[model samples]
Target: MCSNYDACTKPERLRMYFGVEPPPRIKSQVWPLYEAPFIRRHPHKDVGDDAVPAREAVAGLFGLIPHWAGEMTFGRRTYNARSETVAEKPSFRDAWRNGLHCIVPVECIYEPDWRGGKAMPTRIQRKDGKPIGIAGLWTSNTKATGDEVFSFTMLTVNADDHALFKHFHKPGDEKRMVVILREDQYDEWLDAPASRSMDFMRQFPAELLMATAEPDRGKKTR
Candidate 1:
């Protein structure tokens, strides 16, 4: 599960890679509950069904807030939804059944490597050094104060058989990875129906990914 990641906040990269404009402000590094940009199909009403632009970028919390959530804190544990149970999980089913698909533009995702008997932070990114679009679901919630809040959750798939991702997490725990969609599949993912959404929940090729150890220097006490 991806609990930490860097958001792609560069306006030029957001436009050239995701084909959407950047939000006014977004955190460079995002954790659960942090606001970040996500791309989804523009509402038909806004485009009159004949507009040229098909996608739009909107800022939303990194964690998904289910409609039934009594408080925003509920999102902390929902930042990553298992693809296998997303369609049935109470926290994610509504967004899945409604096809509220979205693409999370990420600079890189942080994972733990425990090969050396200790957890080492690893930064994974495309081999070509380009931003990646991760598959996710987005939802809108109304607070008691009558304010609307948008949130999203990244979709993850089993990675036991994946060459690279199979090494993440712990030595014995089942490995998992986020679904990184190909550039050509971004539109298809956003437009696919709920039934067909599963077809895009597969793992990205290992060869296209590169990982390097990036231990947290801030953790060292003076």
Candidate 2:
């Protein structure tokens, strides 16, 4: 589903529009497409963070694949992981099992809808400028050529009243929203007992989210 939302061509322009400099992750890949804001703002960024290396020079494709998967054209670009069932998904099970640490940086993410036979898009973001730390699962994949591909999946939970019901309502379904973590809560999320990660992730506060539909300025590139 996230495939429909093209990466922001000039994600760095977010700084000019948002009036703040992006984090290292954001500064590095602000062109071609928009990535998660918190990822752009990650504080512990390095080639190998806690024994895990960056999958790509920058962010990898949004869809996540498990290390055991066989070669395929698309391999199913599953961008979002269901909070309720992440522990059971074939793709996300091991990463979570191995205690992989991941950060999904994002500024505003776009979603489209049709009303009165016309299309409209919503730009969702925090009212505050702080990047939303979307908790995720990451893994390392080795291609036939031997290039390592590091990938991640954003965990999803029911939307908050402010984000899901307030601004994200669509015709058929708006039941899902990406999980956003607070700075103080990041450690708990990253270090939570596997038994509790899903529970802790499902209850993201609603007040932190703020959004409105905009005539897509189409976030720009470097």
TM-score of each: 0.94, 0.67
lDDT of candidate model 2 versus the reference? 0.54
Model 2 agreement with the true structure over 1-222: per-residue lDDT tens digits: 233332222445433332233333433232222333323223353545654422222455455656776552333555677777777878778777676756565665665545544546666667776655567776657852267765567777765353353344455665577776766665566556666766656545556666566775464554
TM-score of decoy 2? 0.67
For model 2 the local lDDT of residue 127 reads: 77
Scanning candidate 2 in windows of ten residues, the lowest lDDT window is 32-41
> What TM-score does structure 1 among the candidates reach?
0.94
Best by lDDT: 1
Query: 1-222, model 1: which lDDT tens digit per residue?
Result: 898888999999999999888986678788898889999998863656665568889999889998767788888999999999999999999999999999999999999899988889899999998999999999998862257888999999999999999988888899999999999999899999998999999989999999999987233121
lDDT of each: 0.91, 0.54
Give residue 109's error in model 2 in angstroms: 1.5
